[model samples]
Target: MKKNILSALLVMAFGFANAQGTGSRFGIKAGVNFPNTSSDFHENENLIGYQVGIFSEIKTDERFGIQPELIYSTHKVENKFIKEGIAYNNDVKLSYLNLPILAKYFVTQGLSVQAGPQIGFLMKAEENGINITDHVKTIDLGLSFGLGYNFLQDCSVDLRYNLGLSNPIDFHVGDENYKIKNSLFSLVLGYKL
Candidate 1:
């Protein structure tokens, strides 16, 4: 399944790369992520993470366009709690290769709204400096919606929220289940090339 997903992503990327027509542009982006998790086990505190990526925008017309990005992103969360008079602090960080293909609509010049599906392949998972990759799922599914502002002819800023649809945790104890999902908000700056 992982191989299939990787193949599909490659094909899609190549197809976009070959679309160097009149209204297409390519760019690089870097972002900060405010990462958190939804969980039944414990409350998670958001932590700062980061992402760097490449993107392509293909304008189909004056008002609409398609934008696809391949990014390396990190998500982090910290939890502190006391159980049975014992204090515990835990931090978890997960890294992924993320692909987001967005549909963009320009509401006005330099202002656009974007919505898309994102697929993330997990690269690493660590808890308090220990590798915990085996305990988590390897793929994540999400939806992204955001606003983008283009300025200075070749620069852009994007603010987006990623809503996670699948639980990344893979642990269950008999009839008990733990529900956990990852979510984050990103503030990104882009430069067209």
Candidate 2:
């Protein structure tokens, strides 16, 4: 199944790379992520991170297009709690390689709306100098919805919200299990080349 999915993605990429007109573009984007972890056990405290990526846009027409991105993003959470008579303050940091395939519809010459599904591959997870990758899931599924506006010289600004659809943790610390899901807001600047 994984091989089939990879093969389909490659075929789509090839088709986009050979798109019919001069409307295809390659771009770079970078931004911050405001991570909000919703959980049943732990309360999320101070969290901050950033994301950077590259994308390719293939226009199927004047009003519609497909934009695919390869992004490196961070998810951090300040988990403060007490369990088993021990107080713990855990600063969890996670990294992921996110693939977002967006369908874009232009509303005007400079504005568009985008919605997509994203697949995130977990790269690393750590908490307070301890490796916690074994307690975290390796893949994450999410949906991204956003708006974009183009500026002069092929530059654009995009604001998106990524809503995670799955629980990622499998283990508990000190007796408390968290049903945590990843939610993040993104504001990225892109320049086409």
Best-fitting candidate, measured by lDDT?
1
User: Over the stretch 1-193, how does candidate 1's per-residue lDDT look in tens digits?
Assistant: 4794577578567856675756588899998998757876555687899999989888889999989898999988886655556676778899998888999999999999999999898889998999999888888999999999999999999999999999997555455576678888999999999
- TM-score to true structure, per model: 0.90, 0.88
What are the Cα lDDT values of the candidates? 0.86, 0.83
Candidate with top TM-score is 1
The alpha-carbon deviation from the true structure for residue 27 of candidate 1, after best TM-score superposition, in angstroms, is 0.7
Q: What lDDT does candidate 2 reach at residue 73?
A: 92
Which parts of model 2 have CA positions greater than 4 angstroms off?
Answer: 1-16, 20-22, 173-176
Counting clashing residue pairs in each candidate, in order, gives: 0, 0
Clash pairs detected, candidate 1: none
Q: Model 1 — TM-score against the truth?
A: 0.90
**Cα shift from native, residue 74, model 1 (Å):** 0.4
